[model samples]
Target: MDERDGKHQDAAQPEFRPYHHPAAGWGAAKSVTEFLVRERELVNGPRAIMKMNHENGGFDCPGCAWPDDTKGLHLDICENGIKHVTWEMTRKRVDREFFAAHPVAELAEWSDFDLEDQGRLTEPMRYDPASDHYVPISWAEAFALVGRTLQELDSPDQAAFYTSGRLGNEATFLYQLMAREFGTNNLPDCSNMCHEASGRALQASLGTGKGTVDLKDWEMTDALFILGVNAASNAPRMLTALAEAYRRGAQIVHINPLVEAASTRTIIPHEFARMATFRPTRTGTLNLQPRIGGDMALVRGMAKAVLEEQKSDPKALDVEFIERHTAGFAEYRALCEATSWDEIERQSGVGRAEILTAARVYCEADRSIVSWCLGVTQHEHGVDTVREIVNLLLMRGNLGREGAGPSPVRGHSNVQGNRTCGIDHRPDEAFLQRLAGVCDIDPPRAHGLDTVGTVEAMHRGDVKVFVGMGGNFALAAPDTPYTSAALRKCLLTVHVSTKLNRSHLVHGRQALILPCLGRTEKDHQRGSLQATSVEDSMSMVHLSVGMKRPASPHLLSEPAIIAGMARAALPGSNTPWEKYVEDYDRIRDTMAQVLDGFEDFNRRVRLPLGFRLRQPARELVFRTPSGRAEFSTAALPDVVPVAGTLALGTMRSHDQWNTTIYSDNDRYRGIKNLRTLVFMNADDMRDRGIRRFDDVDITSTARDGSTRTLRRYKAIPYDIPRGCAAGYMPEMNVLCAIGDYSTQSDQPLMKHLKVTVEASQPAG
Candidate 1:
């Protein structure tokens, strides 16, 4: 009955191979070629549309959160950007005929690629349970049905509103406002799953929850520690910054369990010779492969080395900065000095000599920056791990200085912006008060459910209505079967999106898909072509205006969709919902009054590259209770696994971004046509009687003594550390249990998993 049964996909065995090359050479060329082929029908539209992308008049690339160098900007978009734009600007359409030809049950059997590749959704569709097919529905009826279902909820708490990173700042503001007006704070967003820990940790230590350094700081740093992130596959444009740092004699170190191609070498396509020959530029000066979940200990070992070095040279440490600007250094220094090398080595799986080598580089550097992604924040102790990284930077007087600070590299395009616009369950009281003052409604003071809590609430029948601004929740969330069941239990589920996704198939009793305009299309409302905005990883807000015509004349912009639903649902509410939809500037003006750093929001966003939001830590001011940077004393996590178990980590493929799988091949790792493949160390594979391409059954053990098994996954030998395995998510997400998450931040432990892999019998 579910789409995952996959009856429509080709049952033939998938192809697999080892890719052998650094990133951004021939592989990037292939991506461009693929984009050309995919968008052949609307060829000039893509090229003309791209000219506006990341420019003053064009839209921001709806890909990564990496900032654009607007001062010296070219097209400035990468292959990934092209693919995203091309995919959005494709000529294909899913009209009434397409829906008539395919039932919901049949569409469920299609793969993720097939579902999205069917083309842009041209009209609204409602699930007809009796027919098992989606029937065309007018926007008015769809909005009215959603409103009726929501109004019928036993209590406001029975509704959960989910927001994704793709939503524009204006839409996010309206979405959260509508939820608050509805009297519930269940504004769980994608950030709750990815970087909630980063926000929690950074806010505790630095007064501000966001990263302090901007794009310009990359040039001034003397050393960089890139941890737990596969920069090449995730943020291809970031490699340019890394390459520039290395070129300028900055020591670059990559700390990851697997050797990512971009960390080793990358070719900047903007450079002529490399673009012609696909030759690579060297990146990482040191590549450290510590045991899975050992980042805290590894960082502690580095800190201990710094302390030892300072013993001989007291001036080696930033005495003035530490004594004046930070707290808890005395106790922290004592703990580091007293720490045993054996314990550090055992916990980190790193030798003392190697630790000292990296520490020495840090000691010699004038300024340093530490950047990390989900790898460091997807552990049970994610908050503690990030805190230790902050401790390391504080030891060197790195904060508030040029080229030195902590940057939690966000994966999504506007996830940070979504948080800025109040798409959070735990809203700060001051922000709520501002919203109340602006909207004349009593904002809910009680904290609401996060992603995990939302799922649990849905399962318990406490939440009956589910509304997703964007994103495929069923496929992106952990514990797939559980999450899917929660969605099915809902009285109504709605998704505002550009194309069909798996989440549409995993429906509730009643489901609605309201197709919307993508970032590549113009959004003309209030008799004007409105522009939307997004915040980059560095907290820089910029305007993004779509150039091409909308794929469908019927598709509504997200703000328009939210307005229709809001007016219908909150009939008595007095907020100017139509005004926001008519002119996005009104929403920005409201944000300027409501949010702390968004003063003059409309004026600033109209600039060529927008403006940077205020970051207090940028000026050495700590927003903590102590009025100074506070050091954390979290101990290393206890991560010992059961005997014969391998630590499993889930990651995205080269051809994927977040949950959107562009292709089956991870070209950087040399994988092709096999998303069900697992990467394992050769020694570990041999020890377990497993070989490359061997059929395996992988079981993930939950803390509650339960397990979920994935069958018929083929194991591939790779350069990963021993006793560690890597697999693509959504396919592997089912193995993760619902209760598996960080205790402090409530973020899922997506990267750290306990699993046992065994050889399985092949098909008869």
Candidate 2:
């Protein structure tokens, strides 16, 4: 690698073609083979890791939140899970010599893949502005520097603490405990960017903020509505569930602007014959392609159809359930009656025929479920759209019953678990009182900043220190340049991480990278190998015990690191930080005290396959303000873009998970060896006088007359909506301003943007 003028050596020209195969069969096999070949030096390690991954007594796959069966079945992991595992357990290492040879300035310009590809961090390191490189530092000095910086701050509010989804419940509890004890509520996390909309919307309508359905619900559902969830890429394990539902003769409907490969076909990983024949089973019996930001209108149309059907048979409308279990139904029904089909089609970009087809499927099923992902959450009307979905479910009384409810397919492994474990900026009074009673520390009451709030606060010169427990905050947050500038302006930035990322390069005046044990590595503290717990997508809390040895002797567990920092920062605190680290069960004991649903935490988590947490919404107990389920209504997103602009959708390639790029190829989308390519409709390209593979510049036109532009993106004509274009995230994240988020949830509209595309070079 060159020391100056940074550029990736592995960056390829990229070959693009139409992918015609099913989602998960031979193609998935090839991807796993490639991962194995790349990590050949890590010999027998691969076989052993695969045998234990996602099992009852094994470590959890730190990728997506899709639940595991814990059977230790044959090759129990998917292609995406294997990529995350090998990437984490790779033989490559980043030691003192590696940093000495490369400067931070040069590394900052490296590709995201290259930055992480350098390998696992081995020890604590500090940034030296004079030399433009990082140097080794003692753990004590690192902690002392951070504590002194906190002491020197005017108030704890100036310091922001961020967490990621990979952390266990115990570690997250301690991390949040430290943040609250230090008198700041700035506990921003990945959930703020991805599923905050789901939580906020559901909590307002139902009592709980979690999904009400579990894996067993798939077997009972007669029909499923999958909105904006890409099963092939984001959560491949769900495809198995979909296939099982199909075998049981369940109808599935898919709605999205971009027609994903998995939406049409799938292969169950455990079904040996299906994997061998490559004869994929159909997933979506009916697919609806709504316009960008049109999910609310589509669901509204579905509700309209449901009401119209009730005119023929009043029983079609669950009158008894609505009267006994819900509120605001009369107002919601009146609004639907007043809504026009023409208006619905105009806003949703779907004709009456397709809308009626989906409604028919919904009306015919005795038991139904609606599942969605980021595509439904990362929009201006994200929360409204989710509530509309709930409105549809209420029409049929599809909630509080077997195989019926709403499920938001979360992205990270334990994102929902993190929130349940108290990683919130706004803590409830009851939770705070319980925490204070046990920890003997006066926790902060003021609501802290979310992800966007932190970036804006830093930009306005309000924040001085940023301590990231995990995750690449710089690249993950919206408005990349602005967030990076905010990080650079900080007094100090500290990252407790297992590997290097873009967040480390966008440093403050003084920065530190504190190496920590990865999920795949054994976290042996106080002479005993410890196990952590991760709550899955279905609200199942299970034990995760690492099998592989620690990658580095110097690395510490995340809990140990957090406890050490807490001791240094709160010198006079009475909390037994070290005692909890000695045995994680003590931490669990403490959790059982402050948190609900964890009564007998140690005893329950130790059981085979662990246990499922309580979800009050599933028990016909709507804990809303009115003590009943509520229905919500909102104006349709009538966002008519300018004449020259096309609605843009930012997506993740199949090869990546979150901000980490596992490879340069995405065979699922048929783009090989490149991340700079953009997917557009062929007709849209023709209308814009652009050809396939033509290098273009995307200019994002914000409402404030301010704009952000990305250069050198090769436009590839593919299958998408006529007026919509799609590109990978972080590359397109620059175009979205941090302030341009949903009005209620404040989730960055990464999936919806107003943009105009043109040739890279002027009219030659």
Highest lDDT model number: 2
Alpha-carbon runs more than 4 Å astray in model 1: 1-18, 39-49, 277-279
Q: Which residues of candidate 2, in runs, are more than 4 Å off?
A: 1-11, 41-45, 52-55, 70-74, 762-764
Clashing pairs in 2: none
Model 2 lDDT tens row, 385-493: 9999998998899999999999899989999999999999988999999999988989989999999999998888899999998889998999888899999999999
Candidate 1 steric clashes: 4
Q: What is the TM-score of each candidate against the true structure?
A: 0.97, 0.97
RMSD over all Cα atoms, model 1: 2.0
| Colliding residue pairs in candidate 1 | 3-108, 19-670, 59-545, 207-623
Residues forming the 10-long window of minimal summed lDDT in candidate 2: 1-10
What's the lDDT for residue 224 in model 2? 94
What tens-digit string does per-residue lDDT give for candidate 1 at 603-624?
8888767889888888988889
